[model samples]
Target: MALVNDRFSKWATGFSGCDGGDIGSPHSKSIWYCGIEWGGGHPDDEHELINKVLSNDVEFPSEGYTSDDSPPGWLYNLAYRFNWQAMKLLTAVSGDSITSYKVFAEKVKPFTKGEKGYFKMNLYPLAFVNTSHDLWKNGFAKATGLDTKKDYHDWIKANRFPIMKTWMDTYSPKLIICVGKSYLPEFSLAFFGEELTFESEIIDDRELSWAVNKNGTIMVVLPFLGNRNGLNKNVSIQKFGDRIRELLTTL
Candidate 1:
């Protein structure tokens, strides 16, 4: 069963609207990494309780959002597919070799909360087992005043997108990596304040979409890193990361 307490309640209060804060540094030059949403919000899964609690506890105290180091079942654990692959991509993009696990453990440092060079967050605030799941309907309805996921999404598009734009204006990040090419509109509107036209190229038969704005922030849309159709293969992810690095140099 989903665990709810004072902490969850307090977190939901701020998280229910356009003010849902991010999970990493607010550094002006940080690389902003935007995901679809926080995963694993199923009310029935006991495994997600720790994730829920820790997510609530995350804070950005003028430095960056701080998170505890990987606990065994934590979502940030390197054992998790998403976390691992994300690290690999970041490592590769940094022009480092990804063949060694030490790239994450030593060099790139995945999920070290409050990281200065990286900023992590989601377009939507509420968590889910997957994007399509509506199990959070009841929980979010009470906190956000919109029940159906569709309504909440619409509300976020209207309200939250502007706040995101303000953040982009304020921080001026060097790179914005948005996962899920399907949410291109959301990412474009949120970060660039307009619909961005992406140039697509097929690498190893997997499509990689990217765009560069006049302000020097490059936006890239990649398939989900952990999903079935995601860039899970080492070769494909490495190639994509290299392409992103190449794009970064032009700016």
Candidate 2:
């Protein structure tokens, strides 16, 4: 693991702080694919992710992608995992073929670290197997010096949302694809500082919604890519991506 400075470590793990950075290309008006939070990790294990954040091992918010870590095997046989689905959507948006595993492996996954034209972010920093599970909270709280998950979430809401809004204001990213419909309220509060009535449509009986900010950044909301009722089927992803591509041409 590459060594991280104290400031980076603090920014990586802290709840209420700003470091003027994110996990993507430092200078691209790229697509921002935001999720509710990272997914993975358990209660009994050592806090490997936190250690990585402090030591700069895996993907932590900074500038640009990690230098040393190899890309993860998210595209195994084109299974509809979250990251793979996101990649497929992005590829479809770019007017590329999504059916080719070789294309994704050699051409796309390598740049998903944000070297290409997209950013990966989470509204919350902690990693959980899923949102409903809470058993990992104790370990997270202990690692981050917080009392509980509620406190961590509250701090993120009060402090980090504003910072994220500032990034939106400054960068004016053309697209922010939020891939979790359940977090629409949080996405609104984070990006627009209030609840917004998003314009939505149904594809494959799944709801896909969108809202545009004053800065001309479009926030596209979709269901969880990995869960039940997700927008993971090839037809749905292709349709959604095509719609988004069409939408972008107008802006």
Candidate 3:
């Protein structure tokens, strides 16, 4: 079985709305969530932007007309092309509420201004970590309760941890890779605490990969694919592909 979440349907519907010229459609009701813009009805241009930003050389329609106006099908095609099975799984789980997915899709929609085309760029691939309110309060800190803070960590602890664990247990991927440098410190502190040990070579400022376990499952952190600055100097389009390939080898 594949892992999935509610964001998939939300993305599909949101993109469908954009294609149909409904910019302000409500995709998800959650506070930390908002639908993607897709440059407001530039469905055709959005397709091209996806190819360029992802650095893939493929021709996709820049018009509202797809092989079919089936937004879900289009989303699936994009996911497969990008090797984002995680996205597919999330959509599958969405069942009827595809909030996250729709928001992401709409955000990446393309637009052209005068002679220049604009493409939305994402700075990181989604990272899944194991956590919960109990884990944070008990394992991490009592002060880190859900009510006081509601960032990504809190969101994971409150909403995503249980589902994330279930998915990890079921899918059992050999390697879990995180996509950012900033996430490394928090991830390390979150799971390892003061007992964390790093491989000497990876401790340098360059790209680092290490094993972190929670309830016996292991995770690895790599440079963010979307972070063009900071410690991810070498993390270009080519590097992103290489890193993913390396991760697959480990898997």
> Candidate 1 — which residues are off by over 4 angstroms?
1-28, 42-77, 110-114
User: What lDDT, from 0 to 1, does candidate 3 have?
Assistant: 0.31
Question: What is the descending TM-score order?
Answer: 1, 2, 3
> How far is 197's C-alpha from truth in model 2 (Å)?
2.2
* Better TM-score candidate (1, 3): 1
Could you tell me how far off, in angstroms, the CA of residue 167 lies in candidate 1 after the best superposition?
A: 1.1
Cα deviation at 217, candidate 2, in Å, is 0.5
Best-to-worst order by lDDT is 1, 2, 3
147: Cα error in model 1, Å = 2.4
Give the candidate number with the greatest TM-score. Answer: 1
Residue 237's lDDT within candidate 2 is 81
Residue 192, model 1, lDDT: 91
Q: Which tens-of-lDDT digit does each residue in 1-251 have in candidate 1?
A: 22334443444333331212233333547777778887766353333543553255433212322343344222343656766777778878888766764545454443344344665668876667788844755555544455567876776677667777777776787888888978988999988999978899998888888887787778899888867787778888889899999999975
User: RMSD to the native, candidate 2?
Assistant: 5.9
Model 3: residues with Cα > 4 Å off, grouped in runs: 1-152, 185-205, 212-218, 231-251
Model 2: how far is 1 from its true place, Å?
Answer: 36
Better of 2 and 3 by lDDT: 2
Q: What ranges in model 2 sit over 4 Å off?
A: 1-28, 42-67, 71-80, 101-105, 108-114
